[model samples]
Target: MSLDLTCPYCQQPFQLAGEQPGKHANCPHCGKQFPIPASEVRLSRKVDQEPVPQRIAPATFWYVQTEDGRQFGPVTEGQLQAWYEEGRITANCQLLRKGADQWQWATDLYPDLHQIGEKKPQGAAAAKPPPPKQALDRPALPQSAAPITPLSPDDFPTTGAGLKSLGPVLRPLPPGYGEPRLHSFEALEDRRKFAPFMVAHMNRPPLNKMLLVLGIANFVVGTLRAVLYFALFLGLLGAIGAVDERGDERVANRAAVSLGIAFVMFVLNIFVISGGVGLLQRKEWGRSATFAGTLIGMIIQLTCVCVTMMLGADGSGLASAIWIVLLVLLLPSILYDAFAAATLTLPSVVTDLEE
Candidate 1:
């Protein structure tokens, strides 16, 4: 082994060249020769070792916490995450970024939350962490659900720690089961306040599903109506051909009028179909077009019903009443238009489309 020795001439340290016992060696520092002791202790080994360097934690720009309106630090992502896991900071602690105006939750800022614990603390030897988190002797299930009382906004915990602790206990559930969503609370509140037996029809998000159904339905209905209108137009044209205006001006004029109506309807249906396609693509214009078409359809259908009843009723009160009643109950086209209008007007649907 090479010997780590002090050069007696210069009092400087240097390693000897060879592994064998030597009598004389040159001091690289002073450039002077020195005697190597024959039976001195070997002060060096094959491998040279040095103390590992202490790693410094890197930090980012400053952030302000919302809870106490106090700035946390110019801290690394890992350190912030560690504070969160330690419950020194809660999810409700909204942080305003260095150059930003609005504040966002820590979870929103840091997605790699649970993994931060795996990293060694920066300067772990010098820093003193908070009291070691302890396990409760009592069961964790009940505590997981902090609020056990009936659903009431008044009774709800408004504090961060309280709210953080409030949630359905994590069960050893099978697949497709997990933490109860926050929306479920809204359902519970409604049920308790309204009808106990009424179950929430929609627990999942409605935007995508409704958009798909209504968009496709609009497309299909518009196409079918267009085909019907075109067929009627063709039939009218044949009538006009069979009975020339010269032969029967009245019949030909009526046929011409019906054909024009059919043509206009077909053109409108094309717009409706385009609107439906737009809706499927989640365009604002599609929602607007579909909504406008729905309103026009409702108006036209109602007008037709009124006009037909007045011109054809002939004072048959019973028949006219029955007709109006049936139309009100079973006018699928107008009713569907109204329904579509309602869905499109919903704030959730509108907001989703904007997004």
Candidate 2:
């Protein structure tokens, strides 16, 4: 590199090859020899003044030397220039100088800048600019005198620096912002049961879309099944009543009476099915109607089971037992739906109270 025709020591304009990094160069005018920044001789430093409010940007970077435990600014050009003018370079301050090949740091170069005047400007002391935000942080900012702009993802460094390039810049998220939210839904299974329960059960009012749908479907199906099954049973009973069997009158009467009783039972089953469906659907009318029907169905089934065991044939007894088993099977779903429907009803009840 070419140098101005002046001596660095005396400001003489004489020119020479720029001093090799470590060589000591002398000026003909002043005979002063200053060591060039290199391995052999280094300019040690001391901080002449503490950081001033105007001198330091709200945010700046500093380099620390591990060997000597001194901090210096290499990238902060303005701050470094100020320190240089202040003659703060000492034997203890950290220095990070870039060489032809690689960057080297030294701690015995200057004093800490903290010794400078510690006073800061009054009223509107410089405030640091806010940092970037992450996903898990605040969803939005609150309304305030000065609105804050949200940070973008691009503000953060995605890759770390390496031997070939500068290290990654890691800017901390600002206060009031939260951590990044998890991107994957892999953990959703763990929360499935609890999430639904809370939405369905705990919130003063229920707001579950799935539960509501299920309740309604149950009511519709139950009503339809009740209509069909009771219709079939009654039709069979009517046919029996119309029969004129030549057999013993006692036999005919018994058969006709049993058929009548079964028809009656069928009529009741319709009500039970209707009620169960209604409760599942979470309709207020359905919930109540089903609850009543289920209880009655249970009673009638148990009674038929007893009657069959005492008077009917073994097949009849088994059929009655099977019917009882079915009734038992339906009991839990009916009860749960009743409770759920009732739970849903509570909100309306509360609203009524408020009104």
Candidate 3:
């Protein structure tokens, strides 16, 4: 049933079908985004009541948090019914399945889900007997304006006129060759094989091995700088020993405070190293947090460099130059990776199934 409902945004009526809940059907008049819910058609009813199941007229969507703390899309009432019928998901379950292969839909249902015990082993499915042969009528040959040539009975050497015992059975032309062909079965098979491989290649992971290598290198260098800073602070404290004993005490205390601050930086560096590498590996949390943290770090580093230059800093030029170089190396890469990760398409899942 398609219901004519006015889009709130556009004030234009559009057709809403029960099967298209949460789908992006729009107003033709104004192009305002609108979704069709089952209730809009006034046709929702329990299709099956045997298991105490009820199908509501319209389903509302809710954001669900998975076990791993990732938020998924809105789920609908029809989807909820299907999920309950199938054992793959549970009602009100907090824990969602692992593996990027699992799905969370606008409705709690897995529309792509297979019916239980429906899948046959590939080999067994392939072993079915071949289909029967189809008869083909011989096409009439063009008549030549020449005397017809005929073969003598001795040319065939048959015991009965135009008859012979069967020597071998011929294979059948496939199902496509049978009468009332709706479509070519051979063309369908050819299309299926190439379609998936091409799509899979196109949708392959955003990060190549090279990006992962760069992530690892970034982590290592950050960790090394943190360690070197700690050593530098200790050496600075030692240098203050040449001053008067009381003055030296004050310098040593300042050095100790600086070392403590450097230690915090060390911890952050270690976090970046691990988190960034994890993101490159495509771990969900790793991908989100690494980029998020690195972005913050980039801002902080730039600010620190500005403040230091403003203060007429007297640090060793080599130390400052090394930091500048490291900052330049990492910040752009982090930003690029973050943008890429966010924009990458949701990995494709089976969107439709044939009966």
TM-score top scorer: 1
Residues 1-355, candidate 3, lDDT per residue (tens digit)?
A: 4556788886766565545655667777887776666564444333332366555334343333432334443443333233334332322233222222232331233333223323322244245222111212223223334442333444322254433332232334444454765658876677667797555446565565544654675576556655765686666556556544557565566556556655655555665677656646555555444455455555555555565456432442235666567556556644643443343323431111111
Query: Could you report the Cα RMSD, in angstroms, for every candidate shown?
Result: 21.9, 21.0, 36.7
List, residue by residue over 29-104, the lDDT tens digit for candidate 2.
7888765545322221212234545542243333323223323333333343333333443322334442222233
Q: Which model, 2 or 3, shows the larger lDDT?
A: 3
Clashes of each: 0, 35, 5
**What are the per-residue Cα lDDT tens digits for candidate 1 across 231-300?**
9788888889988836987667756866886787677677779889988877788998888887777777
Model 2's lDDT to the true fold?
Answer: 0.45
Clashing pairs in 1: none
lDDT-based ranking: 1, 3, 2
Model 3 steric clash pairs? 74-106, 75-106, 75-107, 76-106, 76-107
As for lDDT, the candidate ahead, 1 or 3, is: 1
Candidate order by TM-score, highest to lowest? 1, 3, 2
